[model samples]
Each structure stands twice: as structure tokens, then as C-alpha cells.
Target: MALMTTDTRYTKVAIALHWAIAALILCNLALGFFMEGFEQPLRGFVIQTHISSGITVLLLSIVRIVWRLTHRPPPFAPGTRGWEKGLAHLVHFLLYVAMVLMPLSGWALISANPPPPPPGQIEAAPAPVPGGAAPAAAAPKARRGGPTKLWWVIPWPKIGPIQRMGTTPQGIAEQKLLHDTLVERHMQIAWIIIALLVLHVGGALKHQFVDGQAEFARMGIGRGRRAPR
Candidate 1:
């Protein structure tokens, strides 16, 4: 069993991961909202950045989970009610679920409906012949649905089964339906994460300001106070 500690603040590693993940989540959320306004290459770049951030979050979250399992966090501040503790735990659990599922559902959506060819991949039409008759245009390169690069660096493969879904006409229809469903789920989970964040931050502020507890200090943000008995 992990040692139960009376330590007032989170360990350095935990504190680092917490802030890093929070920053990435906020940035990715902004990217998701604004990406549509961008044109071609720029839009693609934004999307690649978002995907890279999401994958990073997933990896860091796994590390955080392992760290949590092995290291006991400080107990609740004194004067905390039983209901408050229960709500805190529930909100935390849901947040974890949202973080993991949001990226995965996005991955599935893209796999089912691969993005269009990136800039410079599509061939241009052949110039008009001497008689003012246009020769046959070259066939555009096949859309193989290539892997998404992490921040335009490391290659990240899509989910194979979903990536291969729309080869045939019948399969195309099925893939479209699946893609639509995943899109809806992905948006739904984003909203859930937002709501949970509000509750989590609100509770922390309440403890710190309203109840006179050193809440931020427990997360390694500020100076510690004596735990209420």
C-alpha cells in the first residue's frame, strides 16, 4: 500500500505535471475553437498542434495516475464537510474520464473521416493544348490517409480499423455515420470537461477565500497553513 502522508503540499513532480497538463488543456481548447477560422496550411498547422497537445495530455495523465496511486495526497483541510469531500472526488473522477475520452473520440472521428490532402499534395490541371483543347488532367494522388505528425515532427498513426473503414461505397456510408456520431460525442465530452473545471476551481476558491483554508498551498501554489482538526 502507498504510504499515507500528512505532507501539506503535493510533491514537485505532481505539481509540475498538474500545471503542465492544465496549460495544455487550456491551449488545446482554444485551438479547437479557433481552428476553423484559419485557411489551408495554417489550419492544418493548428490542427496538428492540437493533436500533439492532446496526445501529450493523455501521456502525462497516465503518469499522473501512476504517481497518485503510489503517493498519498494530503488529507482535506480541517472543517471540511463530508459532502464536500464526496463532491470533490466525484468531480475529479469525471474530469479524468473526460480528459482520456475526449482525445480518443477525436482520434476515432479523424480515422473514420480522414482529412483532405494537405497543401501541395494535389496535382494541378494540365495546361490547354495548342488547339485550345485541354488535355486530360492528371489523376490526383490517392488519399491514403497518412499518419498525423506530432507537432509536425513524430508520426502518429491513426486507429487502423477506422482508418480502413471507407474503402467501398457501402463502407463509405457506414464510415460517415460513425464519423458523425464520434463528432457529437467529442463535443459533448468537451462541454463536460468545461463544466467540471468550473466546479473544481470554484470549490478550491471557496476553500481558500471563503473558508480561510490554505487550499492553493496544498497544490504547491503558496505557503501552507495548519490543517484544521
Candidate 2:
């Protein structure tokens, strides 16, 4: 009987992107939760570095995803456990979801409740008013493709409680309620994503240190060379 082998190690591109993004997300998560929400003496330097690194990770992730569409990754070993394969897929999918959602949520959360404005500058609406449609006779504008549209979601304004008008008390309350609800939900999702990420890191460590496997190297520096079937 022959022992089975496989080209299971992740590709160099995938490994590099995976580790890079993972490190960025982990740092950002800590900065977001520990410093800001935790009420620590807000260090401007930490947050600036976090934001800059996160943007780099996101850009690289996009390129990696595009590369993946073009170049297929190696397959796992035949003897590999099913649960692990499933978990691996789940981890990756969750990562992508969290990566995209966290930033968007951050943006939305910031828009809803931003830092104090410069003295004199008036805080305005929750979101921007949508541009009015052109005359009926005018041709519709060309639709831009991909996640670009997702980011450009109807421009919302950045306003605060100061802008609330006494005349529209009911409307104001409703909008406030909606904004609070969204902000709360976004935060909850972020926490859940963070928990999952902790688990993910733990699992990788377990595979690397406890099991004495080469998983981390395969993902981090792309060292492992999976054998041809």
C-alpha cells in the first residue's frame, strides 16, 4: 500500500496574503477594542498605524482574491480529516466577510457618531441626500461594477444630536433610534468576528506548536512543498 501525498500546501500568494491580512486584522481588532472602546488613554499613534496597515491589508486581499480567481490553489491530502477541511473553509469565508464588514461597519459607525467637530463647524445630517434623478428624457448613467458600488452606497451625512430640530420631534426620534440600532448591531457583529478570529489564531497555533505540523509555515512564509498526487 502506498502512502498518499498531495499538493495541499497553500500557494505562495495565498500564504503571504493570509498571514499579512491576519496580522493586520489582529492588530486593528486590538486597537479598536482595547484602546477606543475600552476607554484607554487614546493613543493617536496606535490608531493611525492600525488604519494605515488595515488599508494595506485590504488592498492586498483584493489583489490576492483576484489572483485566486486566475490561479487555482493546491488541494489537501486525501487522508485529511473532513472537519478540518470544513473548518478551514469556514475560517477563510468568515475572514473575508469580517474583513469587508469591519471596515464598512467602522465607516458607518463613524458616520453615525463621529468625534467632536472643530469649534464652529456644524455637524450635519446622518447621511447625504441622494442626488436627484435627471429629467425622464435623459439617459441613465452607466453602472460602475464590483464592490466599488458597495462602498459608494448613497452618500450619508455626518450629523449629531446637536442638529436635531424641535419641530420634527417624532422624525428625529425615529432616525436616532434607527442609527442607534444599526450602530449597536455593527458593534455586536464586530465582537463576534473578533471571537472567531481568536479561535482561528488558536487553531493555527495548535496545528503549528502542539501538533508539530507545518501549517503556519505553509501559510506564513509559504515554505511547505506539497507533493504531487
Q: Local distance difference test, per candidate?
A: 0.76, 0.54
lDDT of 1 by residue, 1-229 (tens): 1123345777677788889988999998889888989998898789889989998898888888888889878888889999999999999888877878888887788787533445776533334334433333332233335578887788887887886655444444456567768978988888888999999999999999999998998777878954333
- Return the TM-score for each candidate structure: 0.82, 0.59
lDDT (tens digit, per residue) of candidate 2 on 1-229: 1122235565556766777877777777677666665333345456545545655665777877776677665565355578977987898677777776666555443343233335796533232213522212211121101121222343333334422321132333334444456668767867878778777878777776776667665554445654454
lDDT of 1 at 212: 93
- Scored by lDDT, the top model is 1
Best by TM-score: 1
After the best TM-score superposition of candidate 2, give how far the Cα of residue 3 lies from its true spot, in angstroms. Answer: 28
What candidate 2 gets wrong by more than 4 Å, as runs, is 1-8, 37-50, 113-179, 209-213, 221-223, 226-229
Go through the candidates in order and give the clash count of each.
0, 5
Model 2 collision count: 5
Model 2, TM vs. native: 0.59
